[model samples]
Target chain A: MLKKDPNFTRLKKLGGRGYLGRVSYWLGVDHLLVVEVTNYNERYRRFYFRDLQAVIVQRNRNRMWGNIVAGVIAILPALGALALLSDGEYAGASLVGGILVLIGIFILSNTLRGPMCSVHLRTAVQTQKLANIDRWRRAEFLIETLTPLIQSLQVSAGEAQSPNPATVSNPPAASAVQPDFS
Target chain B: MSTASNNVLNCPNCGKSLSDLPEMLPAVERCPACERQTRVVVFPAFSRPVVKGATAEAVMMEGEATCFYHAKKRAQVPCDECGRFLCAVCDLEVNGRHLCPQCLETGAKKGKVQSLERGRFRWDQVISTLLVLPLISCGFLLPLTSLAALVLVVWKWKSPPSLVHNTRLSLIVCGVLALIEFIGGCAFWWFMLFGSRRY
Candidate 1:
């Protein structure tokens, strides 16, 4: 069994929920931990800050498609409400307008949530897509938070660096790794 | 060199190459071919070469400890799991333990090492689904499905469990559900065959 690291803090606003599973992020001193849980079983992936190559956030048209579908389906109730209002049936109009309002709320929330995005992390050997982090805002937060930590660790570890030494992002406080069992 | 790194970070949606854009780190650009917006953040390791592991030194003394795998190679550390002496080349450090190749593989198979575990079958989900699906889809098949669920749950009760929450409660629920379905199915069948009918 994988023991939970007390030192590893769960990243704020870094969790994904889906019908199948959930993906959550935990930050260790030197590495980032991604835990994926499905049907009560968990899988873990660790990416050391020093080994990370890049993080790419790609914006997609999922919101537009969602809006289009919802709008098409909502047209009937909207027309019904308008027709009822024209016929002077205030109660019927209000009842029909309620459905349109619910649909409007859904569309408004989708827009408020902003555009959809997909985030992928690249390493020397592998590039893994973050299944849960599909928002540009969350992706930006990851980049802003991670870029500095990775730069500092690589520089401190004496790994090859192309970035300037003085401007390396200040790493989050480092915690001591657990003692060896051997 | 820059193009090589950009090649792998292609458009996730349309599978088009975004490398044609100007050379800049931490920049957002729209893929010309796919017209999708993409944000790229490159770290320092993006341009660095892969660091190689240290090689084992040859035995210089007549009585020097040797690697468990390689007899002539000098031993530098012992494996955390197996306690076998390992040379620098043979020592595989993961999470913090200095494990030999064999112990690492064994740990991976036995699920002792967290890094290597990729997936696990949730028996509770399996048993629960088996017990519920038949009742919802085909009520007549409940007896057979419930019997199967009961047998499998009892059989796998002592096996390796799910990682997070204790599945004992779920198992009990599954067992009870399965038992109820089985008894109901049997009673219905008995009534059909033996009970009086008002026709």
Candidate 2:
């Protein structure tokens, strides 16, 4: 049987984008998880092995409409510039067209990225979304690593509370069959 | 990858090992060994320390600044909100914002700061509700109520942010409803004058 250790080591670093699009990291611990939302704010939540209700991983695909709308808005000025140039306004046409094309490229590059995966820890009190663990591989690895430790902890906790097997099995057969009101 | 049998969880009521439990948590199962029931909950484990090289340094000299929360501890950083010097233990960093416990608590209670807030009041939804509901129940006061709703929508267009990502659907609905009411009022007035003359 494995003994419980008080000194916790970080098993995994979950990384994700935080508020105002800042990259943040969280520390996965055996009994406690520390989420660093920003430079000054950190949330620490402790859970017993028997208290954690669920660990959920959800995949969110990038919305194409946002990219499409951005692309369309970006090209609007360029299209307007084309109309102006056809009407013999060369200066206005060139300036607007150049700016719009650059803006469009910038939006397109950012929007071309793949979907993001998010990890969530649900307990009796509340469900916390681990913003830092956004990648599927990392999230999966965290789940895999923690499952055994949780199982071990549960087993140990259970054993500590349970009565001896020998004592339980050796009860008199007559006493087991008879219902005691007391 | 470790198999289920490698670290089998036992029933809390019984010493018997439980095998093949479902992945979903908060499950109730009868222990075969003891004929008693137990609820199974699971948590992930950590093998290493998450925060590396984070240790509270001692206050060395008498002249050096000390933490406001802990006077004996050496001050490492200043709280972003209150500008109070904080030790390593007192400095709570959230999304690049360094804050002391007092400021954190205050921000959470008042909902002034977005990072500290758990939920937010959606003004757009309020505006939309006010605009649409008045028109349905009080058709006679459509012009007055819708105008007031429009004014509110414009005034509180950028009120407190929502807990979840908002698409401004409520604002759009309010705008549409307000416009319809305004146009209907104008049409009604026009008909009252011109149609009366025609009759």
Candidate 3:
């Protein structure tokens, strides 16, 4: 429901704090529905369930952080090897150090490249939950607005269909001619 | 809104039209014209889609009528080799394909399975320790501190159960570097301090 709103488009375009602010606002709405409602079994299915697209976006964003960290790790080995080469005395120690540093850098780089969807899946689920809460709120508003119209229809129908006036009158002899109010 | 009857279904006994009957009521109901209870049954009654079959325990049969696994108590999956019944739990997803439990067991015992052991290690710490170890022998305190750093890196690398290869590599590198640093430092001290005095 939040995604459908034009305001979301504007917020997304704004970027920076605006994007983060919109996401947090939607998250708050989702949190409210999760906490307040007790009977909506379909809420999770309709709103909070993780879809594939959302999962992919989340993973892509998360991997950027891992990549940056890996890049930083890669720097260490290069720097260490350079330092060891400059110090000619500890040649044996330097070789072992160089190998270990290089291996660590390789592992970090490999892990950064590998496929990881856990982070993305988690964020998608959260977003879906927020959307479900927004849908529930709209459904409640419709019900509240329509209830009075239904009651009016019931009253009008009752007035039109009453038993014949001649049979089983309210008072035994009270006629239209007298119209007494005692 | 109301529409004209698409097809007139009349009661057999009274010939009274049954098309105007309420949608909520069963299609076959008593005809007032006959003053007796009668039914107007249709071949394809206007009921919701029948997702389950007549048995109700299994899904409605579709193209090719696959067998249902009574033991597993699920449906819609067929074995790869033989088109027999197999539920998802009983099905093995292998090498871009689905194989039944029997096939999976045979394949596993035949050593046709891939070992999934992707390990994690702190590459930064290992590299740092190794690099620092060689520098340790330049001064007595440098080697001591670098040895401590190497021990820490090895410990951290070995903590996780998955990444043994990466951890072992780092450990070996750090240990050898530390040993070399200690021995080289001792040799240098002996040559400078004692060799000159003896001469």
Candidate 4:
């Protein structure tokens, strides 16, 4: 878990450029400083996993609020009918009352459709966030675990940076040493 | 790392990766892949891990509804009409009142619950009025049948009043039609009885 990540500070400072900027750029913004920050990029794209997770979480939280609002809108027609019916005492009360009840049920069914759709969308986004996080975590683990090996390679290659013909004379000893592992 | 894979070249101006490292940095000490005394920037990756079910916390965070009448714990039963959260004891049965106990009581007191007090007028009343109105205008010696239908329609239409005002107009038209029927019937009867006397 301990990492000497230089870009961590940069990522934290830059934040996950919100969806607005990304969308604006995609919509052909002329002044867009377009940069390809793929999830494959270990620096700039680090926050994407968390951003996706936040989106899913936010959507799920909105579900209950949306459901309550939809439930309220469903019954508005019944209120309207009652107001209209209050005009006459009873000569048409039974008929209007029956119609209002039926209309209320219909409206309730209609309102439920919206929350149901949102619930489905939220569930889908939640699943996508979980999957993306899992992929990013695995890739990050591999890249971090290999950091020492990569640094050692860098050191050896740095010594060989100068391509001198004199240093190239030892090609035979390097080739013969590979057969002595046993 | 030496085969161009480990290190990345960072632009001096913006610190972003410069793919054309040799072109951007002329005095580059090491190859683009190696970070030895090179202008290549090695930026490390940072990850913040979140558990899969983290969003479930948000689901729990949404506020719960409170009962309208009891105002005790959370309420789940939304009123079909007003959308108010009403407890079992508070729920009203009327079509639109769908109220808490307090509102239900108020509605009952105001007689808004059974909006039916204004007498439901049927089409049959107008039909009956039309059938019987003629008897009243013709001065029919016998006033049992048609006269009764007209009287019932008028009284019902007039007393409680119809929810639809058209029912009153319908009764008036029917009454006129019934009167014509009654006058025609009496005139025929008088003609037959007097024609025999003239013969």
Candidate 5:
């Protein structure tokens, strides 16, 4: 077993659905940005913080019509049972209505679930989706955390390429002397 | 190059030696020589040299088991697959099973173990076959088989995908075909009953 690093602090945990999604949360990050995706099998990818260009979140809209149709189908049996109850079939009406109610509840729970989103972490080399973040809220949070960190790293890298402040300060003295000439 | 061989830590920004700095992993520590901040992440495994156990000695003594691969080397463990005596170097541990090179190669070639596989059977293919085969054969049980195929696709929708990537194209095709079959079957039954009453 690989030992956990004490220095590593989990900023946030993005919950995903299914077994592969559950397994991704437990994988160790060893000094590299690891994006793991699991469906039937697990796939792992690593990225350097310096190489990360962007983190994107794309929202996926749920189809309301599909849910509505499913709900209608589920309630049809109960509607039929109500008509039978009016004709004095109490026992049959109660059993059929009870079953349809349970099925309707199941369909309603699925319909009421929040929208899912895809999270993509892009580099110059390749763009990869982080499968563990399925919900839109979690994808937004991850983007918020990573975008700044990458930007800061890029800022530092940019600063390194420019001339040092100590060496460039003497050249600016010439600009200050132009004010005296004016 | 010599400093790298000696494992001397250096500042990435200024290329200044940071051997004297206090060891702190995953933390920004200021380099004393360069006055620059450097983020260091150290893995403990890299700090020490790996120790390999001594190789099996020669089988000079009587009744001592010898390695099948190397006759001069004494056997430490038997191969789990073929029961061949193996030296420490020849023993390969895979999924807790001690296998020789021959068995490992054969197992990989035959696809007996799923460990090396990257792809899997697609459920969509199964559904597609179930829906289309009955229709192609003009079987009387086409309606029932198509219904079963649709039920399977719906039931396994949220199930973990197989090794193959699932586009759900097959599921849609199967569903459409199944729905058509169901509608035709229902219409046929209605016509038979109502038309016969008219006759």
Candidate 6:
């Protein structure tokens, strides 16, 4: 008999781009595993589908902050380039602005990635914040992907608990509506 | 399980109650208290009751063994690690192991429980840094650094490896590079002193 290994396996790379440690998601038969890997340590947090209560996503100002910093960095060089161009020193102007294209790339990419947001998961006693899911699209993707799995698992458990889902007649999670900002 | 687990969805920022606007959820809703924009995804468990935990039962028979901790309660099962008798209240089921409190504590302290491991020191990083630092910054100290790397590879061979990366390959590569660097450094020094003095 061919038997599948009943263990947490690698899943989609759900957003967790940490500065010091990278947090990645894994999937098991009944739970979602969040592993944070640092240079010296590996921390684990598991959220079972049956116990998952809610997913809260909040808008953040990451891109705005990032662009503001990039703008500050680009200012001095931009002024220098303009002064050189006014003096007809095209060589100096190009040289000054050429390297500062790094700021342009940063701003463009950040803007194209869309608005940044933070996703949080709440259970009965614990509310975990996933700072890694910073982008709006990633937050939406995370919620969209997890809703069905959690809903199905809860429905099966509810079936086992009672014959009809009188309590779950109007399951909010089962019919999760997506926000445009997610 | 508590009904709070299923029916409660509060503002993540100000911790204010948003229960009155429950129908407008899974959308961008500004909190009245903090006025910060929030989007909440309510799952099935948001409306479901909390799953109740197993409760301890009274003694079933006169001849039945009593719990080790509780004199009046029935002994339901034996601990997986220590073989101690545990009642319903005392028997903590984790990964199918009906362990007593003491056994669970001991196992956690010793890192015997895989699920309880929070972190591990990456010996691979230590050894790799030892081998590579001198080569990039101080070429003259390469021999000594290589020897230290080699020694660390042998010393921490049985230590816990990195969970994110393949560590055995790193250890092997570090050991090999260290061996070659040490041998090359020794040979170069030997030739510089003796070979140059050839009469």
Q: What TM-score does candidate 3 get on C-alpha atoms?
A: 0.23
Interface RMSD of each: 9.9, 17.1, 27.7, 29.9, 17.5, 4.8
Error of 5 at B43 (Å): 28
* lDDT string, candidate 1, A1-182, tens digits: 22354767777687778657987787778888887888747777888897887777778888899999999989998888889999999999999888888989999999888778888888888778887786667877777778778878876775443434343333223221211212
List candidate 5 stretches off by more than 4 Å. Answer: A1-3, A7-13, A19-41, A63-66, A72-75, A87-113, A161-182, B1-199
DockQ scores of all models, one per candidate: 0.26, 0.04, 0.02, 0.01, 0.03, 0.47
Encode model 2's per-residue lDDT on B21-138: one tens digit a residue. 4332224344457644233334432111122334567889988999897778899999999999999888888656989989988987886664444434556655666666766787
Cα lDDT of candidate 3 equals 0.38
> Model 6: residues >4 Å from true position, as ranges?
A1-9, A87-89, A163-171, A180-182, B1-6, B21-24, B50-55, B58-62, B109-112, B137-140, B184-199
CA lDDT of each prediction against the hidden true structure = 0.75, 0.56, 0.38, 0.36, 0.54, 0.76
What ordering of candidates by TM-score runs from best to worst? 6, 1, 2, 5, 3, 4
How does the DockQ of candidate 3 come out? 0.02
The C-alpha TM-scores of every prediction are 0.74, 0.40, 0.23, 0.22, 0.35, 0.84
Residues forming the 10-long window of minimal summed lDDT in candidate 2 chain A? A172-181
Model 5 chain A lowest lDDT segment of ten? A172-181
> Can you list the residue pairs that collide in candidate 3?
A47-A128, A47-A132, A48-A128, A48-A129, A101-B127, B119-B163, B136-B143
Clashes of each: 0, 20, 7, 12, 1, 1
Q: Give the backbone clash total of model 1.
A: 0
| Residues B1-199 of candidate 1: C-alpha lDDT, one tens digit per residue | 1223323456666776656532443444666578767677766566544445688999999999999899999999999888999999999999889999988998999888866777666788889889878878888888888999899889988767654436777888899999998999988877887774733
Task: Give the clashing residue pairs of candidate 6, or none.
Answer: B6-B46
Greater-TM-score candidate between 3 and 4? 3
The number of the candidate with the highest DockQ is: 6
User: For residues B123-199, what per-residue lDDT tens digits would candidate 6 score against the true structure?
Assistant: 87887787777778987777788888899889888776655567778889989988999998778778887988985
Best-fitting candidate, scored by TM-score = 6
Which 10-residue span in candidate 2 chain B carries the lowest summed lDDT?
B44-53
lDDT of 6 by residue, A121-174 (tens): 989888888757788778778777788888888888776876244444466544
